[model samples]
Target: MGKSTLFNRLVGKRLALVDDQPGVTRDLREGAARLVDLRFTVIDTAGLEEATDESLQGRMRALTERAVDMADICLFLVDARAGVLPADQVFADILRRRARHVIVGANKVEGAAAEAGVLDAYGLGLGEPLRISAEHGEGMTDLYTALLPIIETLTPVDDEPETDVDAEEDPQGPMKPLQIAVVGRPNAGKSTLINKILGEDRLLTGPEAGITRDAISVTAEWGGREMRIFDTAGMRKKARVQEKLEKLSVSDGLRAVKFAEVVVVLLDAAIPFEQQDLRIADLAEREGRAVVVAVNKWDAEDNKQAKLNELREAFERLLPQLRGAPLVTVSALTGRGLDRLQAAVLKAHEVWNRRVATARLNQWLTGMLEAHPPPAPGGRRIKMRYMTQAKTRPPGFVVMCSHPDKVPESYSRYLVNGLREDFDMPGTPIRLTVRGQGDKNPYKNRKKSTPSRLRKHLGKGRADE
Candidate 1:
């Protein structure tokens, strides 16, 4: 299919591997691509091959499937010289089932070779295929035309038209900026909560649930931080969500979760331990985001102390994933415990964005190993040689060990839990990766060698000698 040539021309770099043989691209490769004025995420998938189970081709099929699922569109390349074959038909069928947007490329289309292949591809039922000699860079204009509509629909505009209504109504000058999204199940007082905090009619407060749709993002300042607060619609059980708009609103709220660094899961003080609330917290934990649990309308509770203790106990027992997350009680109507809520959010955010020094991490690792040595397997003591912080933004660590595979998952969990407790990294996801030590020592060649004559002269070497 000559993907390397086409990829080079599009990405303006030799990013994809080119070979005379077939099926070089076995995994998904993402690169920012530009066609004329349009820019979008381009994914290169393996050349779809037919294979039975328990074969290399089967593994390639699975890999390609995942890439197809992730891509917004698929640019399927077919060899023009060979024309569309049975394998191409099978590949086209697979793409047609999975990818919503499929654009076909008839490669090596020079002189008379392309005419029949281009016509043959239409039989694959993917509309008219774009014929281009990728090596010579011809017929790119046609390819550009095919991509324009896809880009317009999928990619969002850089700037939206400034609404005059917002300009006239919104206040001028500096304000405290905080972008917070209030999310929970129906009747969680998400909108009411925000209205009480802002002390205004910024959001429409009501008793009936699921009133808000399309996350209502409000710009304001809290303490000193400038914030954009978002009020999202109530999320409901999938079976109960009957309306199309409700599903869309739920998706929008989910998207808000990704954009937010700190998510405040509002809980009903009356029914605090709902399954939906637990699921929301789990989502935040899985996404490696900071989370704060707000028990709203707390003033209404009769046995406040008993209720708080019960809730905390339940949280520990049920949500082990968010073991050290903050649980703040607040009355949305009266604004009681508002300060505590703000403080909890800031602290959680700090933990989420925390970074650990490599030296400190190694020191901690050394202490841990000394206290509880790694278990011996088959009479061989497994040595965890060294540790390093491989990545941040949720601080991930890599442990170089004699046997990576032998390091049990239970032990990894122990280290992760310890990290949360010892390092003050609560309510944030921490990754511990175990890597087998390579065959060659990186520092082995760097040691200075003493000459034989010098060693002999010093061989009155020891004071005893």
Candidate 2:
């Protein structure tokens, strides 16, 4: 049971995908783990399978071996509820040879049903197995005790005094990793594209529609930029997603989109934009994420120019909200057009984060007001006082005016489209909110008439009286 349950518990977040399906987690995920007073980096890997050839399971096994070789200590977890199986014994032998130090642990040992399995774990010859329940947070003290000594021995008690290196030496601070999430419908080459970017078969891919269940994340340096990329599960229609597992997978994908700064919506070359594809793109846009619509598998297309033009046309006509967003065509299979895709993503992110000066905003607003004056509704003029950028990273603006409530939706679109064209925001979601400046005197809500006692006192104090 090398599931990410313990990893999630230790990291204190549902960072890993969990389900009843075997091999749900096909990639290695690392997280900063905290065990009460102890802190360490934990790497959760795929389950150990006995496959040895070049099949998917075999590749997974090879990846796990790499993780084992790199780890200072390996915590080999076995399913206590299932008892010690032959596969467990075989994996134990492999770890003994490959891993430097191994600690055996029996996971899911919450009840008496698991006691026999815990006893059976002794046969692996990896020494005493800690009876722990990763889901219930049981036997954690015992686990803490087991790891304390090994951790102490390995980690130096004291090292060189740390310096404020970034704060003092570097003019600019550490670069923040750009958060990007690749989302699409089933079998749209999302994982394949990411695998090409990584230059490795890090994520499992096959002919199957939904081979990936978890929205896996990995760190990489792409196009000379550090990034944390999320590969989410394929999202199908809501009616089609009836199973519990699929629902969870879709939800995980959504959470990834929410966390990402740039959302790359991948479309299959064969079926460019399905109904589900539109929904996914709309979801990212509604979430205020910078959207980049990419058409994948371009190598298969014979009439490349025609298809490109058609896709661009469809993008504009379907998603006008993302009027200026970049639509790049790429082939994940042969890694064609990846450079263009990279440049497009970077440009989209730039536009998403671009902030305008208040003076420039006001100047642009004046031109817009002169071009199409706001309509006088009910014989009351809705004067737009001024405009200022309220925030960046999706670029929200506030327009102070006389009658914000009376502003027409069409006028709001006009201002938004103007911002996109004038400020070069393009495909990024721009938030334009109108806030009304008070119509009359400022103290309209205060008591208009004076209190009786106060008026009497004022009269008595008058010099004439």
Candidate 3:
């Protein structure tokens, strides 16, 4: 009953939205939790409910079931004040069958009023239920005790002696696995594509829209490189996302995009480049993430060549900010074009992490300024003196200029586009910042006092003396 409260207590922060009303949590929310000396990922899930397979509640139940399957241990909670209800028994049976490890918690058992319910929990055939008052912070010691053995077992034992080895043996070794997020509008086959990549039903997928509400991450090896893929909930237009749960789902998807190094904007070929799709792509670009556009449902299209041409044109016109980004046609349902998708993602990630040598950057800058000198706003010429790369992940640069603030945004865009074209970097966000010479010059505005003037002043003083 107080699952969110207990989750907040363990996580040491309020992450889940808790209310007196049931079903406030419709998605699985996870956070790194600490209990005394133990640390693990804790998931707060929706309250157990019974409904037909096609109902919305049933879909929520399916998500909870998936969470249970993913969990190492499930904390099955019951309302001790209300005793064991029939729904409690139904869900307890589910935990027994589905979950590998379960700890039954009798919540709200703060006083003698809950004693009878605490005893009744033992009859549910889950091991002895721990009486707990999640709101009052009770029974945590008992929880730590219960979890200690399991935690010790799960923790890997370092039996071998540590060896001294060079940590930075390879300067140009393989980079960390790319964190890729697949994002799109509702029913755009985000989950289907992920499932296809995983080659298993690791994620729950169906014909139903909004089936996925959580951003689930799974690791896979693709094309001889490891990849961490996030399968996020389908996003809808802001006006259409009126319900609270749907709003949370959309925010969760946005968070996935922010955490991602590369985002694959999956568009349905049947209805490619919708308004919502453009919004998602724009958001990714603003977040400075490498982007790859994948047109899904290619197998269902009758005129492949014409549709491909149309998609290319639409991509260039609708999202000019992400111009020259790889747009690959795919059928997530049929597993077609998956190799190309993976290659595009790798390429985008490479470009996203690209760095330019200072010499090369200045060379490019020289040519750019020669081609189109910066505008002289108010007739004050803006001289760009020097340019160097400031940082990489999205390739940020800083230019020393006579008047940095006076440099127009249009000129910055020109330089960014130039870099993108000259460096063969496409579909990756580029940043440029201008810095003014300012008062750094030590001799600026300094006047030289001639010897004659000094001698004249000195003579006047001598005469007064």
The number of the candidate with the highest lDDT is 2
Backbone collisions counted per model: 12, 0, 0
Worst 10 residues of 3 by lDDT: 161-170
Which scores better on lDDT, 1 or 3? 3
- Write one digit per residue (lDDT tens) for candidate 2, span 1-465: 845988998899988877776777777778889998999989888878789887878877887888898898899998998999988889999999998889898999877898999999999999999988888888789888988999999987756767886678777887899999999998999989999999987787877788778788889999999999999999999999998888988999999999999999999999988989999999999999999999998999999998888888898898888888889889999999899988998998998889899999999999999999999999999999889999988999999998788999999999999988887788999999999876587776787799899998899889566
| 1 versus 2: better lDDT goes to | 2
Give Cα-based local distance difference scores for all models: 0.79, 0.89, 0.87
Please, what are the lDDT tens digits per residue for candidate 3 over residues 279-383? 999999999999999999899999899988888888888998999999999999999999999999999998998888999988888898999988998999988
Higher-TM-score candidate among 2 and 3?
Answer: 2
Candidate 1 residue lDDT tens string, 247-322: 7678878877877777899999999878888888888778767789899989999999999999999999988888
Model 3 vs. true fold: TM: 0.84
